[model samples]
Target: MNRFILSVSFSLALGLASALLPLSSAEAAGPRCLTDCTPRVGIVSAFGAEADILLAETTGRREHRIHGRRFTTGQLRGNRVVIVLSGVSMVNASMVTQQLLDHFRVERLVMSGIAGGIDRADHVGDVTVPDRWAMPMEVYWHAGAGLPSPCGVAGDLACLGLRLAVGEDGRPLPPFVPDGTDVPAGSWHLRQNHVLSRRTAPQGAFFFDYPVDAEMLAVAQGIEPPLQRCGPRATRADGSIDEALCVRQVPRLRVGGRGVSGTAFLANARYRDYLHHVLQARSFEMETAALAHVALANDVPYIAFRSLSDLAGGESFDAEAGALFTSGLAEANEAAVTLSFLEAWRRRPRR
Candidate 1:
């Protein structure tokens, strides 16, 4: 009798262990019943610092994990929401966004983060909710002297407005080939920059501008969230206040313009000016455009708010001579704007 009872107990324990294991591929892929069926607004950020403010304020939060990534479901500004970090680059953004969509009942998507400001006139700490986003780095890097110059008379149907990629000093950059490649296939020069104002032939019907959801954009437009323009004020050991990292002007919110993204961390001023002039790009970052792409494919209404952390071409950390790298308020300011937008959205009259 004791032996039989022990065998039954072992079987029950084994079944319990199996139930707690991660779902198998086929099971996870199906539209199976999730433990939580709550419809939530998805808030995506590229990294921890950007998501930290929102995460801190989230109430009634519950957490879940998939393949080690955390997806937190919670209430923010009186709305049901799910928030996750999409990691850092364009590829990371694409992967995590697809995962989030597949696993959650996400009704709408909202993204906010710090970004490189393309125009010098646009100071750090200011927030911008771009009307459209694009992956400007997708391009055919022309073979040096072989491809027809789009600005020249030989420019034809294949030209696709090809322009010489320029440097920070506004000089045309010399093209170079990648280290490992078969020479017989023809040498190809890599252009870190590209002109994406139009589509390349046979890459049929690709978009240079993916417009954000019009309705969500309209909601953001009416929101006038106050933003921080300086670093966190802290007390010294003697209780004296330490200086805050202050930018040139009071941070303000601008609602429309194009925001461009690519794998590159932008530092080239000449390229920055070109994008601002050619594409009307106001912000540069690594993730938002990719997130926009994912949201569009999933038929989800999406919007992103980016706060300028630095002048893209001008102020890197060491290049702080002119105080251009005012490493403050960008994350907090964007988060503030996003939370305010959420509040406004919750209060918006239902259809």
Candidate 2:
């Protein structure tokens, strides 16, 4: 009887051990659920300084790395946030934005950065929240009449526009004359989605002009001091501030205007005028339009806060003002507006 009782006790102990071993294995394997419980807001910046400012204020932070990019997940002013730097370009911005959306539970996207001032009314340190963003770089090239002459009218044409259409052989192609007989040679046209100024296009194409979320825009509007009057001064190597580059005029926020984005860093007066007059853009940057496009494609709500770092080509031929002074001020103003918007968003009831 004693031997039988001992045998039964040993079997029971073995069964208990088997049950506990599975639990230990499951715990060691990590959580089965990878999804975040809380919805996250995505904040993107193109520059290091801009990311630094936002990340510095975040709390309960955790770092993530995917495809060589670092995404910082944290809470800013009671709101869950995911912040990342979109390297300065349309492709870079679009790729990282898609990654963030796929990896996290991001409900909305916000971009805060500095841009070249396209409108004369806007100045350095002034923040702009545009209703929409346009891309002007995507264009169709029309072949020139022929090889441009070195002087006179041909030279002028080449200098102004024809040079952009020249082939690698250093010769201009024949003008595009579409005829029923045959398609014109050297005539280039982009598919609808790649073109800019979709509003002007005859047919719907994936053209430019991505609108910001109206509700998000309203949130930005409600923030106090949306505009700034003055910009911060630049510090010299000796730690002295450069007064010449300082903007004494108080900067103010301008809401509900058009913003343009392109890969080129524009610093030409003619191009700047074209953006302001033709495109009706108040601000021009490198990343916002790309970000907007990605967000829109994913059906995610989005907004941008852009501060004027310098007049695209208005301040100086070499863009001295932006390089020497306004960048810091623009960065600071953008960060301020972004933080204010996040705080207000946290307080607002969910839709």
Candidate 3:
């Protein structure tokens, strides 16, 4: 009887030990457990209106909630796809994209949305597929000295070799300089093989311009979807078209230019000109750069299709332009191009 009891106890102990063992890396990755082995392309948008259009087009979708965000997995244009919203800004975009990468077998990443037009040549409803994306809002806050005198002024106090700018209020304006530059006011400060100190260490600095996947850009360039020219006119509450708000020209597709992202909703023409001249950016939005940065870090191919919803405050700003007219047209154009790209990818021969 005692021998039987000992044998049972030993068996129980062994079972417990086996249960305590950690899972292997392959087992830990949830995708391995899924029955489907097909790799999925990730589709990200900033908000519901954009995502809704894609979701409607996707078939056989199964919804899954992770980290409080809804991800729909299915086929779009016959390509395996997983669609999710990246929220609205840089932080939200980066976080959701990383989460998607962590939980899914995302083969590639693509974003489709609306952006403020920065290029004078591009009109509202035009879809732009930029070759690169950059964050223009990343800056160093150089607290300028209160007085105009250079002495004791924050502008004169060079921290990390950047001079602060004076504000209109007679106080120091935080010097808003691009990341990874050592140039003082007018002259460039050249340093050869300089070691970085703790204070001079690179903070919030990135390559600034992150290029889209070359092959993906080529595929996008090849897509020739028919685009909408004029957005529907804004209507009064009674549903009559407001002729004053209608955009007259047919919107066209522009491929291979630069896109920029920032936290601000730019409305000033002067700042728009600065972005156009300095960065050569065609469109400005709030999310694409962050998504590009995340994708680049992961070595994942990334691309974005952005339709112009507004002029970023140019030529008599119409605050109601997006909601009243351009939003639907932009979303439709983006979806059309994205679907076409998927078809192109399907037909391309695999290496």
Candidate 4:
């Protein structure tokens, strides 16, 4: 028997393989496995809507299930590609990315999805291809505000919050002193990720920001995608388009800016403003940064297209954000950009 083949009883007796899901009797026979998982490009999305357009365009698709996630390999615009939905949130995204990398011989990765708009420059329905991505929630939240409020209110003291978890000299944060700890209400310092390094930053150094492959970014930036300023709303009785939801400015395909992601859904207007001003973040979403992190660590070239679905923090936490995100304009726009990039890249000279 081939070493690649496994019997479920034998595998369980030995123990589960690292980072791999439990295998069923069907998978043990190797029938469900793809004979060849190789593909030139691996396209990923957070959910089905984001990938609906690309999936429709893909040809000769063959699907294989791993850990219950579907990975479909096919020819996209005449280029070899594998596309999968990463589900949603940071952990799910990371797991799916690693699985795709491990199972498929993917040379490059492209992410297409909808994101909340943080910067005023990015209007609703605009497709943003940020040069870099980061996780803004990597912070040390304090028990309470350390600085006294100038306005003398508990919430007002947040205005006086400490902006840095690290010292001015660049040393790591000391143990929590609690009562005298200098931090804001949430202490959203947008602190450094003192783990893996990027570019010049050495390992174990502060590296919150992760830059996508330069060549991929250039190819992405060079193309113009058909973007929509208005999207249809299901709430309308006659199924007519909603004018208020339409972007005030002509929807643009913007390149070069910071994008931030988090595990939580961000909907507070004040927090959105802070992310834009403090981190200069243009796009906000749940999964892209985590996906980018895994790709960068693996040394695989990667890029993402995030369509702005709504003004961040514009919707009430439970109500509007969810509805706005499902609008087809943002989903279709990002998918369009991803398809365009793939076509352009297919014709480009070999690296």
Q: Candidate 4: worst 10 consecutive residues by lDDT?
A: 174-183
The lDDT for every candidate, in the order shown, is 0.72, 0.72, 0.71, 0.72
Q: Candidate 1 versus the native: TM-score?
A: 0.72
lDDT of 1 by residue, 1-351 (tens): 999999999999999878866566544343332545678899998747768889899999888898899999999999999999988899989898888878887879998887888866776678889998876666445554454355554323235534433346754433333333323322232232222211232332334567898989999999989775454533345866434445657788988998989888877776677678756689999999888877765667799998776778764463221232344355666778988999999999887
True-vs-predicted CA distance for residue 86, candidate 1, Å: 1.1
C-alpha RMSD of each candidate structure in angstroms: 10.7, 13.1, 9.1, 10.3
Ranking by TM-score: 4, 1, 3, 2
| Residue 123 lDDT, candidate 2, scale 0-100 | 64
lDDT of 3 by residue, 184-207 (tens): 333211111122322234543325
Off by over 4 Å in 3: 1-38, 143-206, 230-246, 319-327
10 residues in a row with least lDDT, candidate 3? 186-195
lDDT of 3: 0.71
Error of 3 at 212 (Å): 0.2
In candidate 2, which residue ranges exceed 4 Å CA deviation? 1-37, 144-207, 226-242, 314-327
Kindly indicate the candidate among 1 and 2 with the higher TM-score.
Answer: 1
Provide the clashing-pair count of each candidate structure: 0, 8, 4, 2
Deviation of model 4 at 137, angstroms:
0.3
TM-score of each: 0.72, 0.69, 0.71, 0.72
